[model samples]
Target: MKTNVKTSPILHLTYAAVCLALCMVLPFLTGQIPQVGSALCPMHIPVLLAGFLCGPWWALAVGAVAPLLRFALFGMPPLFPTGAAMCFELAAYGLVSGILYRKLPKKVLNVYVALIAAMLAGRVIWGIVMVVLMGLNGSAFTWAAFMAGAFVNAVPGIIVHIILIPIIVLALRKAGLAD
Candidate 1:
């Protein structure tokens, strides 16, 4: 028997809203941790979720807007450099994830492969944005800093995402909340 499961746009929108709000709250949890605060924000979760559920564009939209909105509303990001940097990075993540997932053949490999690719690509974009637009001032941009800022600092959040997001997606799929 074929099941007539349908995914709702409103539900996806609600998911985006909640994820954006969660991103807003993340700053509070690490606001005083020097560079660590912005580096490890859980905002990426919603963006990825949107991509996995809706499509690349929706994910990109959520990723691009969430940080800026949070900054505007709650002063989380505080200024231009980090905020602008994140726009590109987050957008890359969404775009890469969606693209990779669609192109890959295996469902088991899809999320992990896409996620790793997205993470790498997003960080490359983030590093480029920081160096080109934000600049390191007198300091040079190195692999260590890139890895530290782009990857290491985000390790926990990355772990959280890898562990939780697929399960969430699967649950949503099972409950007829996702495609």
Candidate 2:
């Protein structure tokens, strides 16, 4: 008799939980700098990976909750403003990635296109919301800054997510853990 070679859903949940916990710990890490600040947060890796692997609801939950928990635990994001912004932005990363991934065909090109598109859209939305909430009418948001911060600055995190997520997803798929 051969045992099934599939991972359990409970295992995936455990993996997601660990990733969320790691995300919550990132702001406390020592390499954080004042110039980039949370703009270059590494927490996004796991959350985005979670969305890619687990689906939208899980990704949304992790993205929505990570900022609040990180602020509460690490105390770097303060309470009201930046934390709120991240709640929207990171949640958008998760939600959009999951939705786009699902809607498009399962190809590497589709995956990358969806990921990059979601990243751009999510950053723009975050910036727009910030401008409105802060009432910075005259001051302009630099799209260059947005691209630099959201993509260029996050290259390492992006590579990490790109490499790790697919492997994890494949493992889960092989193990029959994914839905």
Candidate 3:
């Protein structure tokens, strides 16, 4: 008998749950330095991995819920803008990564392609959410702010993800845990 990750709902649900839990915990590591904390983007890794291990819908659900749930329990990110913006951003990361990974060939290059695309899409979604949320609060989300938040401040996390995610996914694939 053989197991396929894509066809295993229980396995996906378990993985998504684990990813959601990681979202709540990982931020604590970077929270020590408020300056570099957000830049590290601790919550992103598990969410992106969830997309690869689970499928898009499960990953999206995990991504969307993780922030709000974390804020509800931890009160770290605050519920208004940061948490709300993250809801969309992480959702995009998981959705885009899962979708692309599923659609593209299961090769190393395709993993990078999907991961990069998901990161870009997630950042864009984050910027959009910031614009809408800030506008609702009667503030402007300037292009400079968007650039800083979406790319400049995020460089560390981006590099970390680029380095870490594919390795983990590929390792999981080698271990027969991921498709």
Candidate 4:
């Protein structure tokens, strides 16, 4: 027999809340190690997971709020460029990932494809936001800087995401928590 379970509003809200908490805590936990936090990108993981699990709008809400919340609570990311850029970047990640996951066939390969696409889209959005914000501040953001920060500096996080997200999602599927 096939069972169709529609996600309830309470469940969606709970999941989004949990993922938002994770997004906030992960970065703070990782930030203890100085540059390692930036390299590992702990904040991105939860947003990505939320995108896969909670759908696009929930994911977008988490992504858009995480950075600003963190800045307000901890004052770590500052309120200006970094936090602002991250807001757009993570919203792109959540939006693209959730949409693609829902649209694509249910397969491990499709998840990976969706994830990579989300990563690229998020980075592009980040670059654009950075350029505009920096330009307004009389600073320049070049392609090389974007490449270095988005790709080079984030290699470890990318690798972690590529390896880990699929594992988690597949496990959730096997356990019947993911559809």
Candidate 5:
């Protein structure tokens, strides 16, 4: 008899917890290097990966909670706007990636497509969050600023995600760890 390789609640929760932990720890480790932490966006890797590994809801939970949890534990990302924006951004990333990955054909190219779409959606959500938060505070955030942060500053992280995520996912599939 063969067992079906389906994701159970326990597995989902376990993976979400692990991903959340990684999200918190990656930032802390990268934060030691000046400018690299914000630029490279270490926190995003695991959240996106969780989207691929787990389903949307589990990934969303990890994404939504990680920033605040990190702030509470480490006091790195201040609670007000940055953490809040990050929450929305990462939540979008996880949700979109998972939805696309789950719905699309099980092919390597689909992974890249989903990842790219998720990245764009996350950035858009981040920009929207920043606009509202900044506007309410009498501060200004321009589209140009959003573009710079989302694309220019995050080029390295984007490249890393493009190269690393698919490779990891494919490896997991090959190893029979992922479907």
Candidate 6:
């Protein structure tokens, strides 16, 4: 039997707030080991989750603001380039993920598809932003650098997201919260 499932703006706002909170806190937990910090990508999890819990617009808002807000609060990530570029990258992640998930059929495979597509799109946006930022700074962003930043170095985070997101989404659905 199909029953109506409705989520209000208040709920979405609540979810986005929780996600933003996590974005602030998760990095502290993961940043202890500098070697694994980038690989683990603790800041990304909540934005991605917001994409699913809220819609693209809310997710985009969260993504675009999270880095800048964090920088404001903690002064890490350095506002000039890193945080600016991340504004676009994380927004793309949340926007693309939410859009794809809503448009595609709700299946386990589709979850993976949306997640992978979002990751790729976000990386691509990050590269483009980096290129522009680097150009403005009178530097070159080479293909090798792009490759290393986008794919090669991100392998660990990619693997973790692939394994984790679907499980969480599926579990939420099972509990009827994600209906």
Q: Candidate 4 lDDT, tens digit per residue, 33-142? A: 87667788888999999888889999999999999998898896887899999999999999999999999999889999999999999999999999999999999999
Model 6 misplaced stretches (Cα beyond 4 Å):
1-5
**Model 1 per-residue lDDT tens digits across residues 78-168:** 5467788888888888788777766776476577878878878888999998777545455566778778878888887777778877788
Root-mean-square deviation per candidate: 3.7, 4.5, 1.6, 2.2, 1.6, 2.4
Reference-based TM-score of each model: 0.80, 0.71, 0.95, 0.94, 0.94, 0.94
Best by lDDT: 3
**lDDT of the candidates, in the order given:** 0.74, 0.69, 0.92, 0.89, 0.89, 0.87
28-136: candidate 2 lDDT, tens digit per residue: 5625666554544677777776766656777888888888888877675665556777788878888888788778877766667667665666677777666664554
Backbone clashes in model 6, listed as residue pairs: none
TM-score of model 4 (CA atoms): 0.94
List ranges where model 3 is wrong by over 4 Å.
1-6
lDDT of 4: 0.89
The digit string of per-residue lDDT tens for model 3 on 83-103 reads 999999999999999999999
Please estimate how well model 6 matches the true structure, expressed as its whole-model Cα lDDT.
0.87
- Model 6, 1-179: lDDT tens digits are 64345467777888899989999998898788778776777777888888887878899999999999999999977887888998899999899988988899988898889888998999999999999999999999999999998889888888888888889888987897774
Global lDDT of model 3: 0.92
Model 4 spans > 4 angstroms off: 1-6
Q: Which is better, 1 or 6, measured by TM-score?
A: 6
